[model samples]
Target: MIPLDRFSGHANLYAQYRIDYPPDLYNYLLSFVTERRAAWDCATGNGQVADVLANSFDQVDATDISETQLILAAKKPNIRYQLSQAEQTPFANQTFDLITVAQALHWFTIDAFHQEVRRVAKPGAILAEWGYGLVKLGSDLDAVLLDFYRNRVGPYWDPQRVHIDTSYANLPFPFADVQHNQFTIHRNWTLDRFLNYLRTWSAVRQYIHENEEDPVTDFGEQLKAHWGEGEREIRFPVFFRLGRVMDEPVQ
Candidate 1:
């Protein structure tokens, strides 16, 4: 299992290279919080989404289990960074207008996380969670990259530990209604940017360091040999699942 603690050291690269959600996703989130009130951004790594939340809510408190991530987020204005885990948030009961988890829900213990979310979110408040996956350029070269991830990266990561579907699917929040949306964003990148982004993934970082394989040296050579060195544009899809906390038990 990939320990969560390893991320503390990679905070800067993660902050710099991780993809940001598109503006439309943020707009969809805002629709649920018509009151323009407080929102909690659970596992708010480096404040990327929290920065956007600050635009929509009067008060946005961003929290993460990793103090290193929170420390990086501290530089953002109007975002209060707290060192708290998703399973045990320190916020008071029914205190938030909305609670959002982005890209980090997979790392949480679902039962405790759901209870904590329930404790802090106001009745009928919205609970939104999202996950994203990337697609490389659709070419023979891309196949090589995909195969590398599917065979090499996916197997090493603990399937049960990193899997996120159940956490979102079995939300304890009695949702009266649920909505799912998919958004596509195109990232145009130069060779350097593309490589930097790839290197930021924890799986890739772990594999390189643990195996003593020089990702920078080997992956670069392979990519260049296959695709040549230049600029490329790739489209990535972000999946969003939004549900309203149930106000009352069904009869």
Candidate 2:
């Protein structure tokens, strides 16, 4: 498997600039979960998802491959942070009432991870995995952003990034009720603040490391040229899959 962690070097950037999911998404995920005694947040970067799960569950076990990222993760009394890969874990079988993967699902070897999910999750447990796509600046200023995403730093992005581009539509989810849903992340940010978020992208980090140039600073200039210095509400389109872990083995 390819090294799944690309954000280890910029763990601080991830903790500082990554956008949070919407409340509607949490409500939707929790609605299907009948028993919330214990939950697992796989690939729980920064422990943001686990932090939220801790609010509802008796215990939330969160795991990640990168210790640097986990070190900066959100901490709660009910949350346990551990170093582990997504495809395999140290948790006992039939451990979780709810299993979740936030934006980090694409990093896992899906087939192996799904098998592990089935092994650890209780029968009839709800497994929800979701991720948001490229940020949508207003139509007027988006060109500048797209130029960077598709041109400047595009080649630096990993091949796995295609899954995110299509919003995971083509990714395999061999489970029932794999219902499709869309959620919007609404955030208001000044141009410079938005640039910080862009810096968190794995591709941007790669671009800087490879080329030794700061594209975000240049992109900021392009944006400021278009956007008059003020806060604007930006939206990220979220794609999600919610399924019930079945008793029958996946063929």
Candidate 3:
């Protein structure tokens, strides 16, 4: 299994810099579920998605393997945060009306995670998983950033990172009659803010650890030359898929 503690050191950065799902995307996910009783946000780093679910559901159970990430989770009366793995949770059988994994499904041992989802989800519950791809700045800026991504820090990425690059299309989703939607998560960021966000990338973190230097420091200088001044709208295209959890054996 990938080290669950990888994000622990930078958990604060994740809470501060990670992009949030659009409001309409949350509306779309909630609209499909008839019961708003309970929801699960697996791998709920910083509890971003769980915070939203808390507003709509009676209770939101959020879990992550990283204690530091859980420590930094959003605090709300209805949101219960816990330290747990995605493939095995402490939830009761047939408990949740919805289950969500945002920007995190790719890191899981999916076949095993699917079984646990089956065990906890109520009949006809919705299982939704989504991830965002490469950041889009603009023509010129994108070119620069793409080079930094593919050439500089690319080798540090885990093999499963390919699933996000492909927009989860290549994932072995077992749901019957799967459905999908496209969305964008954007942020207006100053150069400093943008670079700080890049520092939160798992690949970038791995790169810094394996090698004794932070590549983002050097790349930030190059990007600043292109960025000039003022806030730029950074866009991350989101890919989402949802299907009904039914009385079917997990493969």
- lDDT of every predicted structure (CA atoms): 0.74, 0.89, 0.90
State the lDDT of candidate 1 residue by residue for 176-250, as single tens digits.
577788887788777678777777677777777788774555666777865556677787777788777665533
Ranking under TM-score, best-scoring first?
A: 2, 3, 1
Candidate RMSDs in order:
2.9, 1.2, 1.4
How much does candidate 1 score in TM-score? 0.88
Residue-level lDDT of model 3, residues 212-234, one tens digit each, is 89999999888887787999888
Greater lDDT among 1 and 3 belongs to: 3
In model 1, the runs with Cα more than 4 Å from the true position are 1-3, 160-174, 247-251
Minimum summed lDDT over a 10-residue window in model 2 is located at 171-180
Ranking by lDDT: 3, 2, 1
What C-alpha lDDT does candidate 3 achieve relative to the native structure? Answer: 0.90
Provide TM-scores for the models: 0.88, 0.97, 0.96
Q: State which candidate has the highest TM-score.
A: 2
Using TM-score as the measure, name the better of candidate 1 and candidate 2: 2
